[model samples]
Target chain A: MERMKMLEWVQALCFVVVDMELYLDTHPCDEEALAFYRDSVENYEKAKRKFEEMYGPLTAVKSMDCERWAWADVPLPWEGVR
Target chain B: MWTYERKLQYPVNITRPNPAMAKFIMSQYGGPDGEIAASMRYLSQRYSMDNKKVAGLLTDIGTEELAHMEMIAAIVRQLTKGCSAEELKESGLGEYYIDHTGAIWPQAAGGIPFNACEFQSKGDPLTDLFEDLAAEQKARTTYDNILRLVKDHEVADPIRFLRQREVVHFQRFGEGLRMYQEQLDSKNYYAFNPSFDK
Candidate 1:
């Protein structure tokens, strides 16, 4: 997949994960939602790893694989250079 | 405490430049009822919330507002991109251009810079939650005002999505308030400060 397209996929999955997290915070005992949330988190993690390997770090704290501090070098999302 | 996402919550691919529309829409970017204020209000108020669920709601919604802020910036940026000096001046953006020149600065359509005074984060949970409910409505009204002026489908589509989110957030905050009230004494809900009385 293209870099931008892959980035979008990762973003979409993360959105689902974040949304589910908000729901689960209110309904913490819902087993079904918890199952779905776990699945989405797994997918988001996989997609994030793939994008970071090809591109640069997504966040400064979790970019240990980066040889240098590439977080500051990459184009921001608003720059449309993904 | 937050993860980075490289795409907008809703996609914004504006194909035309409309500096005039950009100026109007810029109000939502940094206006009194803008997302920046929304985010700050909720995030700051959460520290005083005694209920975990209510605090979680504030944190999640507050985080979403940051994404909404980015979306508004994207819309303004795309609209102003490639606009010429003559077009900007003709569109009544010359005063803004003289200061920022197409760069995205947080300000209202009338050129009021963003100020924390636009929002309140009173330490009292009841007061803050009510303030939040009112803030969401104000933002919804602002989006409605923007929709009245924006003609482009690209611009209106995302604005509609944002307006819907405001309504949803209003409902959630309402639920949070009810939940907090239910935990209070049946005789007098306001008898004590749940946050401080413990």
Candidate 2:
């Protein structure tokens, strides 16, 4: 998958998970929603892993653990990185 | 309790530098209705919350507001990127440039410095939640104003996303307010602040 397209997917998926989180915070007793939230998180994690593997690093820790200082190489989020 | 992420909530790819747009967008960064104030309001208010659920909501929402703050900062940074000193001066950014010199600072479009006075904790759930709800709307309105005047699609795109997040936050705050109300005595809902009155 294209880096931008994949990154966008990860961002949207992460949003869904967090939105459910806000819902659950207010409606803690909703079992169905909790289940869905877990599923969404699982899906998000998977996509995140794929993006990390292809695009290199999303977190500072991931960048540090690598053989090189990959963090400085990639275009920053503000660069409207393509 | 927070982790750093290398990317923005939404991508910002401004092909053109517009100091004019950056000036307005910076308000959302440090202005009164800005993301920094929004985050501080909720994070500070959560401690006094009697209900755990509402407190959690505050924590989560407060954290998200930090991300929005970063997004706004990125927008301002990108917009101001490569802006020549003369270009900045012509765009009414001369005073700001003289002070910061190609760096970003938290201030209103009108040049008011970012101040804690923009938000309050109140220590009362009702008062705090109402303030939060209003904060979201204010931020949303600021974004609306940005969308109306910003001609660049790259700049407008992320502003649109941030605007939508504000609406969602308002809904959550409304729900959180109800959760807090449920824990209060029905007969004296807004009569007093249980945390403060007692």
Candidate 3:
């Protein structure tokens, strides 16, 4: 849980840098920056997916299974270390 | 599902600590229309979004807001790092020092606590999307305000990155609105639907 929290913090930072660049590429279409942003996003997505696979959903709507909508079982990070 | 990570995706090496500058930036952490509110607003709104593309956009942007929240926290952490009690007292961070003691807590510059009142999730797709659009601009304006007050390069770099995102989100919302309108029109938008009053 501690490890997850720490990586989540770092990923938060990386997410912004990569996302802002991607936003630029969507319109400006700078090939180099777009390429970099795409790579960064893929890396972040992999990290995020892996983290969620282990930790559960970060937001209520973003749960692993959208249909079942399971939010009760998972203990939030702020609630406990386990 | 979201989980917090331990390591920084990109290292933010704060060569020099500036607590005052950190305070100004701290507003975004808790201030109305700030990152905490932005993230909560969009993420919650995603639940009501029936359309896949719009939901995807909300997920992407809302997740991004989580990052902005972290960026603000990181700035606060780096600025307060290694500061002595006396330095903190002298730097006007004494108020924050008393409460958090170098820990990052979300609050506006005037010290207003974080509140959901800063944002909304109306459950109606158009209303929520428009709210998201407005929220993005509000954040962009707040970033502009932050840029005006901040001088440190380490802080400014990330602030600029966040500011640009607001623009991007606005653009996405604009696109989302058009798509949403098209979807509505499939039922014949010429009916003069009163539901559009929102």
Candidate 4:
């Protein structure tokens, strides 16, 4: 449950951080805000990599064990969490 | 930090409609403490958060509310799938059917449309975090009400999960409020307000 909770948090965090990154892209010179944006991106990347590694692939283009099909065994959102 | 990518975190399959569940879950979409109100409130309030951590907290929580909004919509879609006109009338979903005709909308059970009056965006970090704290409790209560009304264990599972999230968010926001307050004055910890000026 705690891992699932952390995964949910990281999923939501990645979305917000990506949004903030876009905001900083326009206003790039704000040193403090930029730092926050950079840190958030780094954290999101780390979390995403960790999640993909621990669990199966969540997104497309990520290579799985099966060579013929990458779309197999899609985990339903409510399956693992709830 | 924010982005504008349109992503569906979960795929909701609603081939058949259950009027009963639709009517019940609709309350969470537009209720006094529903997802729409929560999302609008926090997203708007983040502008006033001077501290980076507080702002980040708002962004994170607010974005989660958007996902919650999707989840509620998914639930509604699943319940309302294959619902007939007669079932809607019999299930007391006629008023909603009249307005949306099987389409999901963001409105309270009492028919009050979503409004900014549901929340505030005061430029003071202390005031904003306090409002957020209260908001989470209100949302948690709403989920509790849903849980009480919903008899289906399958549906209840997700609602229970969502309710637990509200509790966790409340804790995080409480920590955020305390952290923000501490940043203002490590000595004067008992003060109610944490703003720099007055």
DockQ in order:
0.35, 0.68, 0.09, 0.07
Candidate topping TM-score? 2
Q: Quick one: best lDDT, which candidate?
A: 2
Model 1: per-residue lDDT, tens digit, A1-82? 3877887788789878877877777678899999999999999999988888888777776557777777777666765531
Off by over 4 Å in 1: A61-63, A66-69, B1-6
What's the TM-score of each model vs. the native?
0.88, 0.95, 0.69, 0.68
Clashing pairs in 4: A19-B2, A19-B3, A20-B1, A20-B2, B16-B81, B17-B80, B17-B81, B17-B82, B18-B79
Error of 4 at B164 (Å): 0.7
Residue B39 of candidate 2: its Cα lDDT? 93
Cα shift from native, residue A78, model 3 (Å)? 18
Task: Please report, as a residue range, the 10-residue window in candidate 2 chain B with the lowest summed lDDT.
Answer: B6-15
Residue range B1-198, candidate 1, lDDT tens digits: 877755677667687789999998888888999988899888988988888899999999999999999999998998889888889999989999999987999999899999999999877788888999999999999999999988899789889989988998898888788878888887887777778877
**How large is the interface RMSD of candidate 1?**
2.9
Candidate 2 collision pairs: none
**Model 2 lDDT per residue over A1-82, tens place:** 2788888999999989988999899888999999999999999999988888887888878886678988777667866752
* i-RMS, each model, one decimal: 2.9, 1.6, 8.7, 9.0
User: Which runs of model 4 end up more than 4 angstroms from their true locations?
Assistant: A1-82, B1-17, B186-198
Candidate 4, residue B64: Cα displacement in angstroms equals 1.0
